[model samples]
Target chain A: MTLTSDRVEVAADPRQQYEQAMAERWSDGVPLLPATDDAVEAILAASPYPADHALCVLPPRNGVATVELIAINAAMAGVEPAAFGVVLAALEAMSEPEWNAFGLTTTTSSVFPMLVVNGACRDELGIDYRASCMGGAAGRGSMTIGRAVALCLRNIGGQRAGETTKSVFGQPARFGFCFGEWEERSPWPALSVRRGFRADQNVVTVHGGKGTFPLADIHNDDPRDLLYLIAKSLAFPLANPYLGNPENGEVIVAFNPMWAERFGRAFPDVEDLQRYLRAHACQPIDLWPAANAAMLADRGRVDPEGRVHLFERPDQFVPMVCGGLGSLHAIALPSFGESQMQSKAILSKS
Target chain B: MRTHGVYMRPHQSYDAGMSDPATVWVRRPTAAPGGDESAPAFRLDRAVSGLTIGVREDRAWRSWQLIGDIWSEYLRRDGAETITVETGAQVGQPGSDDRKQIDELAAVVDAAVVGLGTCGSCTTFTIKDAVALEEQERPVVAVVCEEFLVHGQNVATHLGHRDLKILVLPYPLEARPDDELRAIADEYYPRMLELLGVAS
Candidate 1:
């Protein structure tokens, strides 16, 4: 239900009252929508959820999310309803039992849900599939959709750090993080498809991730060498969520499509990259101190020979091709280690 | 190093102060009922029986361990059939093997109780395990430490669940002596019972 429809607090004309939205901290150092009633309503109209429909129930102080509430935040993020639908779908997908919102949200770990969009909608919506898609100048999908979720988290969930939230120096992505899997450009099958979605499905993959750990390497040419380096990058001492075992985590290595073609030339099959990444995402025993190493061994995180991989399955690398055709870089979106991605098809409507 | 005192300390300005009440509701001092007595509760009907309980043999961050202890304690004392899940190995930290242990534990138990376990890495996997259990249609309540309640709540809401409760426990996963533990348990257990709607 709409929870509270007690008049939306009548105000003067939104256009006249509004100035540059930059001054409000209601932004990620960017402009924002004022969340005017009209604007919010227009967005809400596009969704299948009634304005009163309860979309979610958030915690530590579980707040119920209604459609209008989501719209208000979406309006604040300057999102169109079409994109808003994607946000709704993404949020809806994350609500799945497998996404484990309860623990991810409550833990002291700096992990939050990162939305990875895939399928035909990625291109149709102009989601940046490569080259600074996660950062730098923004794409509407990356900026608005991501920002909308952050706003929803803030406005709806009431996640104020040091208050209900105990995050120590929370990461930047908490503000908003959205990027598309560059499937057409990647060397491998689309992430959504690999996860069992159809070719045409509009899918949103919800990954509980701490934040984006930039994996930029320009020196290597061969995709294998580059992937090997990328795997090593994911296996870094701090990169592994558990210092004891490499296998507890999942890392998504986002390859720009240009490199995907090349990587495919070297290893055409998607499984080849998964195998390569799995083999290479290893850390030397020296990376951990003896005591820590012992702890890892004791926990069985370390192998007998002391080899620790990021996960038992090489496919945990979660390879996806996304990004512009830029050949030199790949962004590694590290898993929060607790929340694996929960994918759901994006309904064009609500 | 301690943030609790820092957060609880009064700010530079105090416009108004209130008289101390005869009682404050929340049981754990971790949330500092003195700070703000009580919040809403995530309750259950009657009592849950036939459950296993245990936390990982891992050092947890914040109060994640508190949750595990409380969960196990709750299930144990609730007069239910309870067992604790085990990795059959010391599996903590981030790794596939740990996931396997969690998977195994989840399989072994009627349901599972996983927490962020304090560290960022383990928290992620804890979430993964909880979700996995849900896939098996097992009733799971993933505990979120005091701080992460909202984020966890938002996640739960987004996932479209009335179950998969995110239990809120205090942080600074240190031990209180047995008497204090019992006292602490005495303090909140009634409220816990009240919330869960159990006539304990």
Candidate 2:
């Protein structure tokens, strides 16, 4: 019997509850599951934190995200009770100062929190890491978990377009963007392990990404040549990498399993592949207008030989293996330079 | 359907051991108010005459560039040297190039004016760059649109520089005419100097 006015009174029917919730402006233009008290508590039962425990203060509205409130939103987003820990971890990661949640939520750029799930739960929760993993794949965990986080940002964080947030052309991923890495198919260590987490830890890494940049090739079979083309593609002239936060802003290159295997055969070590990409991910100085070129040159992004490297160092480009068996395509998730990728491990309730 | 328990009604409960479902209450989450911490105030001990001032422009607000150029002229007429640094010509991300320029300007300038903290991320970075200049011991006045005053203040506190000086301009300052921009430069110049602790 909560006394808060936030609670809605509806006929004792799931369909009616959903209708009322939408009329109340809670739905993100999609159908929502009834977040009944019973449903919310069931989701909260899987979390170690108490119901009233405040996890993080979301920005824009500065809402306090208590475990209970998040559980309600999660339940409404259709997240299964067992997968509640991932939602908690994603919120925790976004709350990190380096993630710049305050700025990102209100920016005009079409940036959103891109959740990369890892560890054993990726398989159990059905987080998609195969073809069309970013979207169009019908993974329940991918859909519900991502939507829960987005709803949290909208409802809890108070991010509404044309009102509080001025996000011009907010990307489609803003609705929901969660995917898993194809770690088993990769020749290198998993993304979490590479980032210093244990291989078995259920970790969620959040990146402030604008949108997906797709790449495809059917004729190129040479490994170095394919990688070189991929590197060049990553260095899109107007990409955020050119904004100059090379040290903090990271670009994620998602390679399909087939391409990953082919590239793996050529460069046995991941570091070698990174080095190769760094060498070729550059543009001629003439790519920018003269005035802009002079400015870019001033920052040492443009070398004496008139080549402008996309990033300051090779390590800034993160390579992960994922996507379907199709060998011809790759995707570049560009960073929103002001925010850094933050990762946190999920605390499984034993 | 065959009745299992001696002619049970269609709507009647068959599981006798099941307990009534407990209804849970949904409470709206609390919103945390902005923090009140501010950085120590920085003061300029000299007048604007003969002093080198750095004027920063956020390209998102096209008018800021015109205003910055106008302000530079005004400062030059007043016997002061001015250098302008335009950040984020294309986007809000302050790349290494933008950062290096900020640091270099901080090293050389006696005072600074960072402008166009009208939007969300831009305001955050505006405070960031202004605080960095303050850390360099250069007096700085962060110029923000009136609508984002509280946002700028909040970002300042979050960045651990709550006391960073802020100069609030009109809310919708973008896309104004050149004359209006020049007028803005004139109107805000005295206050900007005052915030920077520069005597007339």
Candidate 3:
């Protein structure tokens, strides 16, 4: 297959090539693999779309992302041919209007796309879902796939920090973050399945997550008490949900396998668990200072009981089981407030 | 020269005598920027007396709300009917309603001043709302803080509205006292009208 992207000659020396990438601002402050024609072609071979297909217009700059361009970036990220589809799926999901990529990409907030994968390919692709899956797992699929998407944003979308994007304090996930759900250990159906995809299909769900908010509980063993505390913690006064409309966004609460089992036993239905979490995910109007309280009241956010609910519906508190078998810790991926989580089924050239 | 799957560390020694050192070819990753085709900007080019004007304010910025209120008062005093709308949500039903309101305001008002682009996304939305009015053939001006002036312009340009009129207010409008905000409102009111092509 013929490649249509602009090609440039570079030094044979690895060190010199790395320096060239850095000098050209092509690297994300990390060494990237050279996107040679052979490498780029290999990635393109795995894509469902043709090399010249304009996939979507990424925002901040509204650059047109073509399959060939995405493949070149994927090659630079060292993404395997088999994993290129994940990157494609992610961009498609983000381009959805409700995803609000235009707003999220340029916001002063620390939000970035966090990819959660579910499907039969998880194990084959080495996507980590257990034991420090979010970080420290060093899975090739997780690292390279996530980095590829970030590179696409930087290169194709033109999302430059402090420039095109005014992100105040970009979080670590900006380097690229992808993880899988432990389907076997989960009490509910896989996140993709819950979202209407089949259990067997590989799906990528993109969340405009602000940052990983950690919650730990060593003293409480009762599921209700633990869930209550988790809900309250998510409703921290400064959360983006409290700052704007309560109807938008979802806060992903990740439970370790052990806690999932306990919580699952208490509320067998995932929707019921979400309802429980939503019921407690609120704070009294008195919790805020007069000014903030007045604003909340003015916006009709304050309830008749003086409680300001974090979200309007149960589904806004999305729950998924992941992480290590070790209990007592859960991670909350806070929302960007305006963006809705979007999912797309991954399509690959079989 | 083309090289594939070559692994040579920086510490490894290379011999010049053994032919030319291997070189590789790679594709440029960045996408090409969009072309510079911008839409036309409208102007009222008439007096404000007996005309209706719209002022769009963001709920997130109280300072802008205060300034918007002051500007509304000024417009009324100048014998112009004023309609003001406060928008907060950027997505969901509220966001849809806000966009609809801006569209309706564009239809009814001869001109509009959309403001409080102090933050990143807010600036984008501010320019977007202004563009909506401009698209409807209504004279409009987008107001942004000093810090987000470039961001607002960039968003406008990307949306193919490069010539969209923008008025830059002082940065960090928040945390300032009401009197200071009022002074700023008074200072920038004339320029806002000027950008909207309001005649002297």
Candidate of highest lDDT? 3
What does candidate 1's lDDT look like per residue over B1-200, in tens digits? 11432222122234468543222111010110111222222333445665443344344332333444665666676755554443311222433465676667656655555565343334434444666666655556565556555544444443444345555555534454555545554565454444334434
Which one wins on DockQ? 3
Tens-place lDDT per residue, model 3, A1-350, is 99887777777678888987876678899999999988998999888999999999988888899999999999999999999999999999999999999899899999999999999888988889999999899999999999999999999988999988999999999999999999899988999999999999999999999999999999989999999999999999999998899999999999999999999999999999999999999999999999999989988988888899999999999999999977889999999899989999999896
| Clashing residue pairs for model 3 | none
Task: Report the Cα lDDT for candidate 1.
Answer: 0.61
RMSD of 3: 3.6
Question: What C-alpha lDDT do the candidate models reach, one value each?
Answer: 0.61, 0.81, 0.91
Off by over 4 Å in 3: B1-22
| Tens digits of per-residue lDDT for model 2, A289-345 | 986787677667777788988876777788999999987889999888777788999
lDDT by residue (tens digit), candidate 2, B1-200: 12321111223354678863333334332234334455576888777888999999875567778877887888888889999998872223445578789999999998899987887678777877898898898889999888878777766765567788999998778667778878888998888878989765
Error of 3 at A313 (Å): 0.7
Please give the distance, in angstroms, between residue B151's alpha carbon in candidate 2 and its true position after superposition: 7.2
Checking candidate 2 for backbone clashes, the offending pairs are: A37-B24, A64-B30, A131-A324, A244-B95, A244-B96, A245-B95, B38-B162, B38-B163, B39-B162, B39-B163
The DockQ scores of all candidates, in the order shown, are: 0.07, 0.17, 0.49
lDDT minimum window of 10 residues, candidate 1 chain A: A16-25
Candidate number with the higher lDDT (1 or 2): 2
Candidate 1 per-residue lDDT, tens place, A1-350, comes to 23243222211334322322222223445555556556776787778777777777654444566777777778777788777778888778666655656555555568777888987777666677667777774787778888888766665665556554656667878878888876766656788889998988888888878777766767878777777787888877765455423434468777777777887898878887788887777787778888667656666666666687676777677877766666677777787665557788887652
